[model samples]
Target: MLIVAIILSLIFGSLGFIVTINNAKYLLSGYNTMSEADRAKMDIAGYLRFFKRFHIFLSVTLLAGVLLLYLFNHNWASSYMVLYPLLAYAYLLAKGNTFYRGTSGQKSGTYIGIAILLVVIIAVGSGMFTSLKNSEIVVTESQLEIRGAYGIKIPKADLTNVSVVKQLPAISIKTNGFAAGDYAKGSFRTTEGRKVKLFVNKEAPPFLLLNTREDEIYYSSDEVSSNDLYKKIKKWQKE
Candidate 1:
């Protein structure tokens, strides 16, 4: 995740340098699409200068914010990684309107940009809210159910082993799922090359490991004691 943040920061930061006045006609989005008369009405040079400075500042701030959040082990670090860039772009579009002269086309473009930004903000916010919730584990008569994002149900017939371990296997990559701060919920590949479903807090200990015929699941939550949950699952399995 840290690597992903760093790479994104670098990519966005470099964009300002990439779109120069000479290449603005071919590279910049709105500017490239503008009619010659419409382009003439705008202060392209001034906007480019503003653009360069704004993106540089955005990149630096994003990198710094993520680093600080990660160092403190704040769960918000994950949210910051996504939301900061989006909010920055929103600011960019809002402030960018000032550089456009009274061009009707530019006004329409600005409206479209604002509309898209709002939609993206709402979507990302909704997903973050869902992923941040703690996963719930429920035991049924014939199967075990894990509830919340990336949830799944496992039949009792598939259970092969159930135990509690002090530590988790080292995760190599998140194949499909969410990982923020110490909280991780999703599919991950271990350093040993085993794929597992994890709903565990990395900083918390005594994770419940359930080995099934098809997959290994590691689970932990602040809402329940892992040791107690392990015992319950073990007892339930026998019945």
Candidate 2:
């Protein structure tokens, strides 16, 4: 449900951005191929007026979707909500490239290159702002359940070890995942060649570490009592 809300929010938010004068060209066929002088002489007053109202409507709808996500405690999806606009912008650029090629007789290769560059920027930006918010760990006798960006369910039968630590060991590389600022939410490889999945906010401490036969995972939660969590998991491990 939250995923759907996020998709809707992104769709609406991106449309609002594309309708703006400065950014509209990305979606306007032939706009990219137009020389600055030609662009300057173009009349977009009608489009401006129409998009202005449309932007408002979409913005309002996006806010409502975000509100619902928040009210329902679907916070993991909401944590990265700000990225929706950029995702939308990327969509527009790709779409615009298609339209521009069809109408402007521009070669596809050139526009494809530009589109790739724009996509790289959005992907990097999204990674930098990646954070671990509204995440939780549920420890049971049979398995450990994670609810967040790197969510999963780990059976006790696969667990080789479990511990709570104040800080993570040095990570050599992120094998596949997201990292931004002090938050590292994704899969990473350690200097010791351990494959670890992390969902962390650097500001928070006392992380839970789980070692299955095949992988290691580190996760934390600000909303839950870390000491109590440690005790519960410890009990489960002994069982």
Candidate 3:
């Protein structure tokens, strides 16, 4: 997650240079689409300067905020990554109205854009908050159920093996799932090119490894003892 944050910061920082006066007509979004008459009324140079400053500030502040959050709680850092930029962009759009002198249609588009951003922020923030909660584990006579985001139920018959391990294979990337801070849940590709399901905290040790006919599962939680869970599953397997 930190790595991802760093990459994003660098990318945002670079945007200041990517869109310059020479390429504003081709690369700038709203300005590029405007008719010459409309464009003539706007302050393109001032807007560009504002754009550069916004991105640079966002880049530096995002990195600094993430670093601070990382020291306290990784989950918060992850949330910050998503929240900061979105809120910042929304602020940018609101402040940008002063630099734009387009028609009512264009002004309406900016308002619509801000509204959409707010909706997205709320949706994503809520989802992340839910996912950060500890996943529930329910063992029934017929199956082991994992309840929460990216959860699954493994039938007892298909469960081939269950054991505790200290380390996980190198994860290549998330194919389909949620990963934030030390929390990772869902499908991920291993360095060996194998797909696996994970519901574990990377910073936590001693994960329960469950092998089924269709998938390999790695499970852990900051709220649960993995060794105890492993023992329980082993006893359940024998029955």
Give each model's whole-structure lDDT: 0.87, 0.64, 0.90
Could you tell me every candidate's TM-score relative to the true structure?
Answer: 0.90, 0.49, 0.94
Model 1, position 56: C-alpha lDDT score? 89
Ranking by lDDT: 3, 1, 2
Among all windows of 10 consecutive residues in model 1, the one with the lowest summed lDDT is 102-111
Give one digit per residue, the lDDT tens place, for model 2 in 48-158: 555455545655656675666566544433543555445545544444443232324343654675578677767655544434354678777788887766678889888
Could you tell me which residue pairs clash in candidate 3? none
Model 1 lDDT tens row, 91-186: 888887888896576687787898899899889888887877678998989999999989999999998999999989998899999887677898
In candidate 3, what are the lDDT values of residues 1-239, reduced to their tens digit?
67888999999999987999889989988778888898887788999999999999999999999999999999999999999999999998888878977678778888999999999999999999988877778899999999999999999999999889999989989999998878889999999999999998888888889999999999888788999998889999899
- The candidate 3 region of ten consecutive residues with least summed lDDT is 100-109
Q: Which scores higher on lDDT, 1 or 3?
A: 3
Ranking by TM-score: 3, 1, 2
Indicate the TM-score of model 2. Answer: 0.49
In each prediction, how many residue pairs overlap at the backbone (N, C-alpha, C within less than 3 A)? 0, 0, 0
Top candidate by TM-score: 3
TM-score of 3: 0.94
